[model samples]
Target chain A: MKQSITLGSVTRFIGLAGFLETIKNVFTGKLDKEDFKNIFRKVIMPLASVLLFFAVWYLSANKLHEIEADHLINKALVEQGPAEAEKLRACIASGDKSCQPNALPSPVQVWGAYQTLLADHYVISADKKAFKKKTASLNAKRIANGEKPITYTGRPSFVDQIFTSIITVFAGFLLALFIAVPIGIVIGLSHTLRSSVNWLIQIFKPVSPVVWFLLVFMIVKTFTKNSSSDSAFIICFISVGLCSMWATLVNTAMGVSSVDKDYINVAKVLKLGPMQKVFKVILPSSLPLIFTGLRITLSVAWMVLIAIELLAQSPGLGLFVWEEFQNGANDSNSKIIAAMFVIGLIGFMLDRIMLTIQKMVSFNKND
Target chain B: MSYLELKNIYKTYGEGDNTTEVLYNINLTIEEGEFVAIVGFTGSGKTTLVNLINGLLEPTKGEVLFKGEPIVGTSHERGVIFQNYSLLPWLTVGQNVYMAVKEAFPKKSKSELNTIVSEYVAMVNLSHAINKRPKELSGGMRQRVAVARALAMKPEMIIMDEPLGALDALTRVNLQDEILNIWGKEKRTALLITNDVDEGIYMADRIIPLRPGPNATLGPEFKIDIERPRDKTEMNDNPNFKKTRNAIIEYLMEIGNERKSEVQKEYILPDLAPKSFVW
Candidate 1:
């Protein structure tokens, strides 16, 4: 009974209690009134809210489309007279791509844009595969001659850009973790070091991602000038790292410094070596807080990634959004809206991933 | 020389004008294999005294000696069971004990270390919870893990700082007997710091009161003349137990009252008002 209770609490701590219960209920076919209420609140309510959101978005997009179309017709009437205005109206009524209003995309338009991007990805994948097959012999010959192999340099599809963004964000998050945690431990260990370094953290913490990007650009451009490696990718990840690391650094320092005095005493009484004390006692005690910091760092990194990628001209979702907006085609708005949803969804997923990891590592359930 | 000795120890916090002397002239000595308990009220710097002996904190004046050598730093020879349990939350009961045992016996084989961890954990009646983390355990269970961890190291001396103070009466008594049973077997030099007079009388050969602080000092020592293998229920019927208990409690109350009276000394506040700034 004790073993079961402990196991139950452990599962509950990781936030799998409700989820596991639902799964059990589903398999057992024993859904009661309480379970039904839970399912309604947890699943149905969120879906309803999302439907309401889509409805509002669709209505607003339709309103804007109508307004823009009206404005265009009025301008044509005044500038090109009734014949041209009538011609424009006829063209719009026929639903020609050229005369379509460029406004906020409706839900249907966004869905169409999503399908188009997916089709574009497939086409690009086929083109690349064919290109590789065609160049196989030539590439082998080039490699035999000790020359660089020919490669396909094509515009990345929406899916490719998304993968790029995700990769860059992960690289940035790792960089933040590596740089922040050790420095935080050192700073946390010594009051003098903490106080002296505090000014630097304070000054740098709130600095904008744009500024960090510019700073990284200067350094990376210099270093990678003669190299074949992607400098913009380096700049994007570095900037994202620098922008997001402050929270983790500060939190880690706080966590390390405020470790329970009792734990420290335990460390002392055990006569643990300095390294053992830190690794066994200090790190374990401070882990929950460090994880909290890491969670924040990841979200911040993800949030800043798009901006950095945009600034660095990295072929990512940020660049995709910016390019779509600049293109100003009839479907550009729809495509941008589609990208927006993808970005939001990915960010939410990233946060959940961090949360799950934090829960796994943290002993304090309340945290 | 005694197995553990604290000579003229003075522990103060802060510096210059802001300094507060927490413990003053804390002199104590426990012979080899002797069990001693220091009884003090809350905020009477009992932990400060414990820390001083455990080598976690250095005295402002004087020094602590263990086995006729001046102690410079912590050693596995002296195991401390803290009031808060202090079991690393991330480690399970078995692992917490394993960590301490490993530190104490770095050259021991892995299998040997595991045996020690399991043995000590079982001694605390926590074998069922060997795989459970501290956060998953009840307060009493967590304290038991702490005890197991401390004992697993096989320290020559055990220093307990109110190890059972946070437990309910039933758990407290259970743990007290468990600790005494272990102590009886090994006859290790032990120092227990607590506020409960009955606990002091029940566990130790000598009960010494720590006078209330701002400058806390060791008060008179009351010797427990009761024979070994002391029974808890029969202790109430014993004449010596009653006498010692009353003497310790009376001494504690007297000091407590003195401290309270000293605290109640009124200070005249200067007549002042916030100056209204003219616009």
Candidate 2:
């Protein structure tokens, strides 16, 4: 019990000095027993679990290797007699064509795949820079002769694709915010309007992003048939925006309509003008629900963007994953796994950002 | 002209079969600087009466007039203190008051606006909690903020709709005195609505009873003729306070019984027309 109390005091101190505790946990420095225990529990234990996970992954990967080697040997032996099989075995031993690639890459092989992708990105970016410079000079010459400046079209790298995905989702989210908020307020204020809008909302809210993309792609196809460059970007984002806006529209309407009658009475008592009533009483009171809607819509926008990008054949992470999967090369499978983690991490970071904003704007402490 | 008048005001809620006639023929007039309290039982259309005066709800018949002009819609000239203390939960007490202050005096500098908000907040003795939100405050403190917010608007008339009804007994008395003190200072054309008879007597120069509803109307008026700075303990011993309290209580009890024995079956519809025309 005494030791528990000592550890508790040390933890309380660590909570106050968070960054200092992190540094202390990392270094082989002198400390009291309780303080050391606090640091171990607070930071080191979580890292230890991650390390344990990797160890299990490594062991499982070695088992996959054994299975692959056995399969390869069986395939060679069944296809040939003893003399031919012995020759094939010699080739397999020397790492020839008969040997099957490891089905599950070990942690280190996955690391290698990641490094290769990074190096490829670096090379492609340098090429893109040189291409831009050449295009600039060519365009400048053309402009001097009163001709139109040519646009440079270069293949996007993996990192460039990730950036494209982020920007596309943002464009979609901003558009959703713009379309849903005013519409929600209108529907919320008038009962007849809300009832009329309810039918459309219910019908469209359940439609998949893929179908939305298909519908948008059909319309955009004719308009961009003559100049198709980068029209996929517009089509992809518009589809994402349309598919993700339902949550915000529904939530905003509920928030506005359910604003306390007392606040409305207060607005009336103050005799605020229409604009002031909306800005002062209605918007401020309903902000918590609106922020919640925005957060959900943002995450939805990101989730739909990947599918939209694939449908549109746009330069984004979704295309990267699809292309790498179709390649089915030795390193390509591992690269796809890496892309999965990157997608998950970006989604997680976006959620954390929205959560922080929600916390900042919320009036209720518990929420 | 009377400072404020409800000319044969009538109000009904809902449409068709769902209609509830909450207020009927509520004719009232208050001269400038007069403090009038409309006392009633719960659900007695006191709030509806206040709404009519503030122009929140239009009268089904007749009108609510302010300074000889019929009230069309809500205006800043008539400030309102609602029963729920409708301070926006998101705004700090000072900011809540500032919203009203800024609306009333749009051209005031920010510093001037802040000064007015803080001044009224201080009047309610909530200076320490000026920067705090309404949700953080107690029931009484929240009501004080409401009172301060209404007063800060500096409107010509202030309409309070059951403002102190939700407070505890002790807090109710304290607030009543604080409100009376504030009203005594500038003497704005004030209207207080309450269910408690003593509260009305304590706060107003004249008390009017609203008879119970389904078509509630104003009953007889009773003047609270007690002198200024009246003490609760001292009022008990004073003969006039007892006389006025007894008369109002007697009237309310009589109505309470009258409302209970509604005679619904006897008068709902005529059993047979008083003529042979139906044959």
Candidate 3:
């Protein structure tokens, strides 16, 4: 059904075409093998590496599940009650089949338990009859405990906790930004002010956020006789925000002040107004250092936030870990491990987001 | 009447224990549309004089007058091209030029400003690199961008501080011609500070050599009566050009030789216990 050229003919045609193209490119002085190599190395290799890493992770996860099941079985057997242990000992000594220890749950069994918990806590019941009965029972129990009947069905979920932490972080970060940047500008612009403020910044910069949180907690306690949990959280947030804002302020000011005098002279020659000079010349010139300071401030803020939460019992991922550690649940280790993983992932994502923003705003000519 | 005048200019650094004079009783006049090159050895206060006129630094005594009016500080009317290309690395060549154009013509339409910028950029033969930032450019290209930027403003006078001094020999020569071509067409007043006598003779209508210092002053001024669109090869052949170039070179050589002896004569050890009397 098809008319095909011989392999020799096709090869000859392609070779002739390639040779002509090469000749044309060479004459035009556009023969650039390096450009092609650069594209492959910078773009293609990185993408392939990422895909390969994920493939390895997926395969390993399956293998890890099997190992985890065996470990859990051994752990449960070791943790069996004294009565069960004695029975197992007697069974082994007397060679009897009657006194056997209960079999440990399999990986599927634990997964089923997790699913059941998710369903019970998360899924909304479609059956009105069952929902009404559950609500009535819950309300009766609250009333019997000398409290008003709790009608609200909404409960704070893990996702809600994440949102809370994000909102709090952003709020604190924005407040820090609003306060720090201008202060930094002023400090940076004036040598006298910078010298005077240097001591104050040095004193506060090294002080731990945990100490600040405690100090704030005490202040809040004195100010409000019965402080709400939100009050404590806010105090902690402010403590972390204020304590960690110094680096950004100092760096920004220094960056601004250290802008090359030549650039300023150029601005003067151009007769650029104050706003134009600041925004167009000074700020853009000092951006690399400013972004460096911002990255440091943001990461420091995260560290301080976690420290504050752990110390002050503030509601955040830090608090979640603290509470889980205190609860001593059977799977407390896993929960702690999971929360740590989440924290690290969130921190990494936050840094990546900041890096993206830095890339977006950076005006470095070479870049 | 001079287009620009410097009267009895004096500049001093420090006071009391550290008092030092840098410029003393300097007086000069430049005509309208004149290209004046101030030739000097390093630290001869040539840069200081230009800075004073540009109002970057104030003179201790005397005034700089432009159009018979006292110069106060930096203004859009006096554009300056620095030896080091001062184009903001953040901005592209066209953008850098456009910034000055926009500042000079704040109310002009965007299209009009854009056209002016492109024209100036093309004048410097940098239209191809218009969208490239300073770091993406070679030193010569960056200086060309700086030239484009300064010219785009259409200032009454452009002060260049050894603008082509940092370039390679060929690039320097090419840019010198390009600058002259642009200056001839625009006929704007320009003051250049350079150490090269040939460069001074090639570009300027007149060359003023500044004597060496503690108190450096302007020596003699040589009027270059050569016609424009000068061929470098032919100019070298001209008797007048040869005589002027030789005279400037001779004066500089004499000063240099005198300085060498003066240094030898003035040389003295610190009298530090006769080298510690090492036995």
Query: For every candidate, how close is chain A to the native chain A in TM-score?
Result: 0.90, 0.83, 0.62
Candidate 1, DockQ to 2 decimals? 0.67
- Quality of candidate 2's docking, in CAPRI categories? medium
Please give the distance, in angstroms, between residue B49's alpha carbon in candidate 3 and its true position after superposition.
2.0
Cα lDDT, model 2, residue A204: 95
Which candidate, 1 or 2, would have the higher lDDT against the true structure?
Answer: 1
Q: In model 1, which regions exceed 4 Å deviation?
A: A1-45, B259-279
Write candidate 3's Cα lDDT for B144-212 as tens digits.
999888888999999999898899999999999998988888899999999999999989999988888
User: By TM-score, highest first, what's the ranking?
Assistant: 1, 2, 3
Candidate 2 C-alpha lDDT tens digits along B1-279: 888888888889999999999988888999999999999999888888888888888899987889999998888888899998988988999999999999899999999999999899999999999988888899999999999999999988888999988999999989988988988898888999999899888878999999999799999899988999889999999999999999999999999988777754365565785666755
What is the CAPRI rating of model 1's predicted complex? medium
Q: Give fnat for candidate 2.
A: 0.85
Local distance difference test values of all predictions, in order: 0.89, 0.86, 0.78
> Over 4 Å off in model 3, which ranges?
A1-160, A215-229, B266-279
lDDT for residue B261 in candidate 3, whole number 0-100:
93
Instruction: Please state the error at residue B150 of candidate 3 in Å.
Output: 1.2
Question: What residue pairs are clashing in model 2?
Answer: none
